[model samples]
Target chain A: MSLLRILFVVLVAYPVVLIMLGINVRHRARLPRRGPAVIAANHNSHLDTLALLTLFPLHRIAQVRPVAAADYFLANRLIAWFSLNVIGIIPIRRKRERDGDDPLVACYAALERGEILLIFPEGSRGEPERMAQLKFGISFVAERYPRVPIVPVFMHGLGKSMPRGEWLPVPYFCDVFVGLPLKWRGDRESFMGELEQSFHKLKEKLAAPEYL
Target chain B: MTRLSLPPQVMYALLGAVALLIIASAVVLALARIRPERDYTELKLRIKTWWLIIIVFCLAIAFHRDVSLVVFAFVSFLAFKEYLSLIPTRRADHRVLFWAYLAIPVQYYWVGIEWYGMFIIFIPVFAFLYLPMKMVLIGETQGFLRAASTLHWGLMTTVFCLSHMAYLLALPDDRNPAGGGDALLFYLVFLTQINDVAQYVWGKSFGRHKATPTVSPNKTIEGLIGGVATTTLLAVALAPWLTPLTRIESVAAGVLIGMGGFIGDVTMSALKRDIGVKDSGTLLPGHGGILDRLDSLTYTAPLFFHFVYYLHY
Candidate 1:
């Protein structure tokens, strides 16, 4: 990461995660210490990436990349620069118009370099605190990197605090549950099923009363 | 700018508090060692959290008044956040929640500037009226009364009541015979927390009859009487050094804190029971959340502050 990005993480991101949001992480030890690794989490708010980024130690931030939609994150020059350098996102095209274009190319390169990738399985953020259907793109990545351990992280309350359209964040306590790593089950169907089940189990672990 | 200086009395009181914490840590450690089979993890974690809480609180008050006020304001924010996160709310109330949060800094600003007039009425008058008005703009009428009442009640408990502690710091030194505002603030907090511990300890040793068994089953009649006695005696002993209260007044203050603390604690328990959750949140390891730690303070702070403000300030 650049010096400016590190400064931003230390000053802005740390306070937002540690103080303002006050995350309670369960099974935090299950998070991968090093990569090549894949973290599949539910999509909710833009703060999801920032919250996940903070889960890693500051020294390892450079090796952690969040796979984001290019059109949304790379809409303009200034945002493109920030998305590329500051957030260190690997912008993937959500829709491939040309048959020759491979959307997973950058993701493949990131895994090859032994970097951790954070992927939100839900294609786009839907209603706040509501989980949308998981996309099958992550199954392709699992097939390519069969040996990499996929960690499932279920987070709650980030949606209520700063869901899609909301710019101002209300300080709500968030709960993060990290599940054990699962390997690709040799087929896309079984692997996706396993991933979906793992997420369900993680969500069930936080069966407390819903506030939002 | 003037250098930050705590009153000599406040410094000695802090030293005394640190010593008590050390003794508590040693005692818990010894108990864990003596009974290896029994699970003392919760006790150990509670002690460890107490150390962190006391150190952070002391640092905030000892640094500067501005810093201390900010710390108190942040505490209110955390408590309010925890309360909101635990309760059910309508989606329409989301924007109003933001406005509710915005009231914290503004309320604390009034306390910071020593504007007692504004500080006392800001939430009860302005926020109470304005928050519902903002919610009305959202055009959702279903469950409107429930949302408004819960939101306002949370502000009253978490922000308005807790702000009295910050206001203590703004109390003029000349009007306070307890050295200054820091000493008074420490006195209230120390007594409230000690009262909690005393009640627990006394209840554990000689508890038989239940006190408000429905609201809080663990609280005992013996604990209430024993805790009040201990607090009253301690208040009288520490009155001259920490407050301008007479012996009789100190007794009244102690009884008020002991009973008020019990009511506050059980009230939170009732809320948790109604919500079908154990703790408010998992912020602290063994203590649940900020609301858990400050439950007693929510009652004691306002009661003690007004008692002193009326008597001396």
Candidate 2:
């Protein structure tokens, strides 16, 4: 990360994640210290990326990049710059219009450099605290990097704090559960099934009441 | 470095608190050693969390007046946020919730400036009317009454009642001979918490009859009476050093705190039971959440504040 990016994460991101909205992490020891790894989490709010980033030590922040939607994050110049540099997101096109285009190329490059890639398999934040169907794109990434450990993280209450379409965030306590890494099975179906099962198991750990 | 100045009574109270914590920690450690087969994890975690709570609270109170007010406001914000997160609300209530949160700082600002008129009425008179009006603008009448009532009740319990404790700091120094506002704030909190622990201990040791079996099964009539007696005795003993209360008024304050603490605890228990959860959130390691810890204070703070205000201020 550049000086500006580090400054932003230290001055802005850390306070927001650590203080303004406090997080209680379970099985924190399970988080991978170094990468060439994949972190798949349930998306609820924009704070998801920042929350995950703060989990890592500051020295290793540059090595952790979230896989975000290019069209949404890179829509405007100011946001695109902040998204790319400050947040350090690996923006991938959600829609592949060209027949030959590969959206996972940037992710692959990041992984080859032994960096951690954070992906939200739900593709978009659908509803607060409700899990949507997992997109198969993550399975493809798992297949290509079979040696890499795909860590599944289940988060709660970030949605209610600052869900989609809400500008201001109320201070709600958040819980994050990190699961043991899931290896890619033989094919996409089994891999997706295992990923979904991991998320379900993590979610069950919290035993959260039905969201309002 | 400038020496941190605290009133002599507050200083001794803090020291006494530290000593008590030390003893509790030693007892927990001994228990763990003696009962190796049993699970003392929760007890150990509770003691550990208490240390953190005390340290943070001491720093907040001893740092500066403005900082302490901010700390209180933040606590209210957390409790309010937790309540809103648990309760059901319509999608239309989202924007209105933001306005509800904005009420925290504004309420505390009144306390900071020592404006009693605004502090007492900001939530009950103004916010009670303004929130529903904002909801009406959203035009989602589906479950509007439930939404409005829950929101207002949460504001009352979490923000309005809790702010009374902060308002103690705003009380004129001359009126309190014992050490002014901080001393009274400490006295109220100390008594309320002791009342809670006494009730729990009394209920545990010799509790045959349930107090509120449906709401809080652990609460017993024996515990209630024992807790109140203990609090009353302690209040009378500590009143001379901590407050401007006479002997009779001290006993009244004690009974108020003890009973009010029970009501507050079970009120939160009822909320948790209604929501179908054991704890509010996992913010504190073993205590559950901010709301769980502050539940007794929600009632006792206001009740004790008013009692003292009427007598002294």
Best by DockQ: 1
**Per-residue lDDT of B61-142 in model 1, one digit per residue for the tens?**
8777888888888889888988887888766777899999999999999998999999999999999999999989888888
Candidate 2: how large is its RMSD?
2.3
Computed on C-alphas against the true complex, the DockQ of each candidate is: 0.50, 0.40
- In model 2, which runs have C-alpha deviations exceeding 4 angstroms? A209-212, B1-5, B35-46, B281-288
Estimate, for each residue in B1-313, the C-alpha lDDT of model 2 and write its tens digit.
2227677998899899889989989998998899899887766766775677677668657878898888898789878877876777666777898899899999999999999989989999999999999999989887889899999999999999999988998899889978888899889988987898889778878899999999998899999999999999999999999999999999999999999999999999999898887777543332257788889999999999999998888
| Residue pairs with clashing backbones, model 1 | none
- Error at A188, model 2, angstroms: 1.8
Off by over 4 Å in 1: B1-5, B281-288
- Say which candidate scores most in lDDT: 2
